[model samples]
Target: MTVQPNIQGQAQANPVSEIWYTRCPVPTTSGIAQHFRWIHQEFERHGIKVESIRAAADQAVRNSHYSHTQPASFREGGNVPPIWTRANGQDTVVVGITWVDEEQLILVRPDSDIKTLADLKGRRFGVPKHDTKIVDIARGQDLRGLLTALDLAGLTPADVEFVNVAGGEFDLREQGERREGRRHGVVEALLAGTVDVIYAKGAVSAALVVKHGLHPIIDINANPDPFVRVNAGTPRPITVNRDLAVERPDIVARYLAILLKTAAWAKENPTAVVKAIAAETSSTEEIVRKGYGPELHLHFDVKLTEQYIAALRKQKDYLLEWGFLKEDFDFDGWILPGPLELARALAADDAIKITL
Candidate 1:
């Protein structure tokens, strides 16, 4: 299905006064840019106000982080929500993709008999059913991870029982008060024997496994096949609303240029990058390093590479096949590479000037 651009009822102004941006609590170039205040500073230099959708008071505005319904907004996060939003006809275009392999683990109790993916056959696998109006990103991520692990073990979903563990609302707020005890429902379920196995990812999950003595049946990130690691946030995309991309290409390109600069900065300062990522993910530096590896900084480069695109397409297809997407859309047509190209040229020019 071709997704028609929906610009009606959008802001008609050429240069938007303010732009909204959001990113997942993961390792992302945009997250690094936000950590150093570079994004805000760059936009302010252009006489534009930058707002964070995650910090919005109104729930409807914060929901834009998942729905992509807000105009003149940018998001760099998991592939699930963006794919769901685009398939549902939200006018958004993919500007860039970043591939960061985090720990995608099929976890079981430390004392559980399940020692490998093959042992998961006929066992209860926990999949969190998030109480959200939009797509269930956690659910999608877990299912994909489980499916991949099963495929590696020469098993299928039909071989196991999927137990729906109830999850709380999707709160994007950074404050600990609002999110306290909210993210551990699935873990609680696992410990209570509600499920025999569960899929988890990233630093937080690593910390949880250590804290609760959970055993990892398989870590997909350690797999040699890149396709095996293709889940929600593995090949995350940077997307901008169609109005923002079309009406003000300069803004989109400039934002991406800052991200490019941030990626470059990350490579040279691994310690600082780890600290920033820890802060971004609400995780400790030790856990972040343990989950993403010591050489995580080297993987921060963002580009429109074919390998990343193919991985993202793999994720999109998974979402569609599982009914997470409302309708199938042209995946290649959804990408707008012009802005990223401009961003690359701008970054290259800045590099030359720095040397001169």
Candidate 2:
């Protein structure tokens, strides 16, 4: 699984076309995406006009974090302009994976006596519900976390009551309407005593636990397996369109370079990152900073270590076994290294670090 991004000869390109870089709601990527204007200005040197598309607030819930667009929408006979995407480990759109250490927290009411994984035996587990055609990768990932923790307790899914709480988007909110976002769904359920335990991801989820003084029973960060790591954390990647990587490899490389550089900046300037995230998310810097607890590291590293690849394989197997994916594809071929390799070579010597 350790993929050393191979340095290759640059491919020539025709007149550069517009670049639509889409982003998801994950904290680090969302914060970075909000600052993409600077990234686009840099892209101008390559004769490419890069446009950052912040998917609709609800778009991630619908596309499973991948932005939806007509095939070849960004290029002539090229793959869609989804330079980054999120699909279940079962989906075939994966091109590369960036191992980010964001963790999901499974919390219980403060009054609950569920102090250990074994205590969850008969407790109600709350999973968020979304009304979208896109695959619910978050739900599946949370379930995997639950399953993993249960296994440690010598239990299984059948030992607990699984409930889909109301939290995702609805049709009424599609037309510039207001509705409750899924961020508060689990906490609401817990507060109302509807579920004994709930799984949450990101800063908002982190806040819910702290504000309510809930008990965190399982932190996905403690899991050593890659499958659970990705499910409970942010080991996913910033995927790109295959056609873009093939046709305009330079643009792909440059784009990735900018992202890698930004990631480095985030690591060195936590306060600035927090401020930027607050402004981008319209939340207080205090809340954003709290979400970025001491355990959260914002740096980006693109190493496909053997452990990572094996974990991905196991994830694929689990997804297939659970009927989340109907067919399997060549996982090895889906990985594109040229862009990452080129990005490393083009980046400033001190701007980014690559560790295998």
- CA-lDDT, candidates in order: 0.83, 0.56
Per-residue lDDT for 251-356 in model 2, tens only? 6666666666766666876676666655544456665555556533454444456665565566666665666565565767666676667677667544333321
Best by TM-score: 1
Kindly give the stretch of ten consecutive residues in candidate 1 with the minimal lDDT sum.
1-10
User: Where is model 1 more than 4 Å wrong at Cα?
Assistant: 1-13, 177-182, 351-356
lDDT of 1 by residue, 223-316 (tens): 9889889999889999998877877777787789888888777888999989998888888888899889988998877788888999899999
Q: Once model 1 is optimally superposed onto the true structure by TM-score, how far is the C-alpha of residue 301 displaced, in angstroms? A: 1.5
- For model 1, state the Cα shift of residue 90 in Å: 0.4
Model 2, stretches more than 4 Å misplaced? Answer: 1-13, 33-36, 55-95, 167-181, 224-227, 279-283, 295-298, 348-356
Q: Give the TM-score of candidate 1.
A: 0.92
Q: List clash counts for every candidate, in order.
A: 0, 3
